[model samples]
Target: MKIHMLPTGDEVHRYQKSIVIPFKNSRKVLSTSPLNGGYRENLLSAFNHDSNPGAGISCSLRTDSYLNDLKLLATEIGLDPATATGISTAASMDNVAIKAVSYENLTVTAIVTGGVEVNGGRVGDPASYHEARGKTVMTKEGTINIILDIDADLLPGTLARALVTCTEAKTAALQELMAGSSYSRGLATGSGTDGTIIIANSQSDLKLTYAGKHSKLGELIGLAVKPAVKEALFLQTGLSPKSQHSMLRRLKRFGITEDGIWNKHGVLGEKTLAKPVFIQQLESVDREEELVALTSLYVHLLDQMDWELITPGRAAQEGRYLVERIKQKYQLDVEYTFSWQSAEETITGMLANFTDVIARISAGGPDV
Candidate 1:
């Protein structure tokens, strides 16, 4: 956009323009967080949804499907936490032939295949079986090889093993859920000189210039620019050492350089650096000059710029398109990844841990 500059004064000052871009939409698939975990709260607060009208609404996680997957994995080994604990404990105890442990009220029975009974007529005796009484006639004996099954003094470490397995399985499921949603993008910016101000009686046009380009929120995240000054030529014309000193001080403060002729930027002042001659002149001149006086008194700003383009929806598809376009045109690899867990998956995983455990079953007989 082109802007007209009117006469400010013999002396003038300028400022550099900068651009900022704050938000950008992402095209990557992100997992939603559980409703109860307050992940949604965190996301909404980050975007400042309440304060900013443009900011979109909050999104929710997809849980049912995710939980189903967790359930499937949990039952994969036919080992609930309870069963797993029993089997693991049995294995550790060297009770090589243990098959199952059933709990009835306060009593727990260890089922063995190739062992004799423990309490019956075989306790402490070099009976047919070791550490147990052999099953006798009519006792449902398998294979005429008199076998004995007995419970160990210490039961299987069922509780601990079951807890560990369930916790581990649930955690894995949670991760999978989260991996489904998370994202980020880049910002764009610009820089240059804009507008003019009159400083002093030098009749120089002030210009704002930037050493380099700066990026802001594409929208106004905030504004941070200093006003341009005008050297008071009146200091030289009239006897206002106070004004001259102030102007000089301002020049020093802004680190303004003199190019012999006039400061292209505004002149600095300590406090009230003499009447703004350019503005005064414009007031006396035409309507156009008056307009310049109003705008040229301070630093001018454009708008914010953003490099990212994140909108809601088909993230993968949009991401592919964005990446391809960026690579093809700018030869830039504008690729980013995001992941998130759904509300259902997150809660379900936690519930699964709370509800189930592994069950251990040991087959009696030889190592086979």
Candidate 2:
């Protein structure tokens, strides 16, 4: 075990299985942890544990009592289970990220462990249809667990407001990476099983009343949480902006898939290319900076049309312009065509045409 000291004079114990922050005195906390969740002032410690059940073990075969399991974990770590509240994730503690941001005397630290291999989703996405009695279903796949500690005292309202700020910051990190939603044609805000814990010093003399975006405290929180979440995600899942710079990754939210692209343009009636050749050519140009830029603009136009911020005709006009730019940039001879159907159909058709042109160019085929 390794120990690190926080700015608030508290010790953070980093163990092989968990990260524990034990409070020396009473502190105020607001959390979504299943063990001792909600507002609490007498909590002794906050923990983020790795609950990975190992390979080939199914969820049904795991322990059904989460609370009891957490209690046992707390005791094993030498923390009083009765006074501890915490969260758990399938992500390993080896991937935890610790970031601290300070302004003058105020300091905020964020500890995050993240994995989004599955269940990454945007807010308001579809839900899994199920009903459970007594115990709820838990998956040991992906979760982003956050623990925040503020050195300065804050009102209960401010602490709650800080939660909102921290959550927004987390979403901002995901947006920067353009993380996709599993359930919808949109970007993911967070994983379905994400959990957060926020702690504020109750003994500090400097008390804050507001933690909204307009405040410096909120700014610090964003500065700390956003990069911490991103770093944790990178450590745990190899997910970073560099890793997400693929045309397919960006277009997946719009219902475009590798097979969809390949099947749409892999063959021209009697002529066909091998699947490997097609994918190689497609991926070769997918990361072209210029092409990716045009794709970003095209998707933004789609978003604007969906939000009714731009008329369908305007989107079509601008979209055609972008498509033309793609052809000109790549020096590919292709014709511009639209189905003149619904706005969605028209815009998606433009994308399909754009992709088809690129694929043909990549395969060294004559313009159609």
Candidate 3:
């Protein structure tokens, strides 16, 4: 792999810096798969400290050991000189920079300087899927700069995680390129990893600019950690995680949404639905019982009704129509609407209303 020149501070802000990792690659055949060495080194460099006098850049500092580790990493991938992101350049330096900047809140920005065209391009023709690395490969080399803004502390291997996110983005970009949709299409053969050195300068750059509106890196980071956060939150509540439907309903009722975290649920509240107290009450009504009881009550009321009032035929017809509508649709809709809000409350209100009507009808109250 190549060792690129140390980056000048002027390229970034006080809060940001950049470094380049130079790579040596084969001119004859570029491998199309992951670089075992490159992938692993990037992860370590992200977390490892500087070997010599510390440079102002966040990641530029490298020691003899770090460099040796790179060489060793290449061996681990065990790719021929044609495929690995090598250690030195000329060899010439295969330099690429991964810059990071800390923001006001709990966040850090990791930027891979180059774009899709450089990073996502392919290298070698397909080796036999089951075959070993080629005897010898041609040599060509280039750089792809990737960027990311991490929303957390400088945890160990954070830099490596950022690199992984970059790899993912590159793969996605490659897919689009293969499908004939990217500008990088038909130009490059593979990502250069041979004889490469990464230089990270002290961070001085402040603002972030990207082609897309949102940081694709942040999205990946969120996806990586969201499940764990969710599980932790759910466990704290002492409720076994439920189906997504129930979970979302609970979150919504607790005022949780994409708008951002808010303790809208207060410090804590009674998780009524979390308990089984109302499960039986909310059990679906016996539709046949509702129908039979209403129908019999209607007949009894008719026997006691005064036919002289408001044209009995029309009145009876309208009454029957209202009963059918309630039985077939309106009552069901009301129950659903309430159930969605809170099954307990919906059932309680429903039963109370039904009972009131039944009592009034049994007492021979006004048909109106």
lDDT of each: 0.18, 0.82, 0.30
Candidate of highest TM-score: 2
For residue 204, what is the lDDT in candidate 3? Answer: 24
Q: Candidate 3: lDDT over CA atoms?
A: 0.30
> In model 1, how large is the Cα lDDT of residue 110?
14
Write down the RMSD of all candidates, one decimal each. 41.8, 2.7, 25.5
User: What is candidate 2's lDDT per residue for 173-270, written digit by digit as tens?
Assistant: 99888888878777789998899999999999879999989999999999999999999999988989887877777787887766777766745442
Off by over 4 Å in 1: 1-156, 179-368
Q: Give the per-residue lDDT of model 1 (tens digit) for 26-141.
A: 11111111111111111110000001112242222122432332233223423232111110000001111211222221111111111111111211222233324533211111
Winner by lDDT between candidate 2 and candidate 1: 2
Worst 10 residues of 2 by lDDT: 55-64
Tell me how many clashing residue pairs each candidate has.
86, 0, 80
Best-to-worst lDDT order:
2, 3, 1
- TM per candidate: 0.12, 0.91, 0.24
The total number of steric clashes, by the backbone 3 Å criterion, in model 2 comes to 0
Span of 10 residues, lowest total lDDT, candidate 3: 24-33
Can you write out model 3's per-residue Cα lDDT over 5-40, one digit (the tens) per residue?
222211221111223222221111111123334322
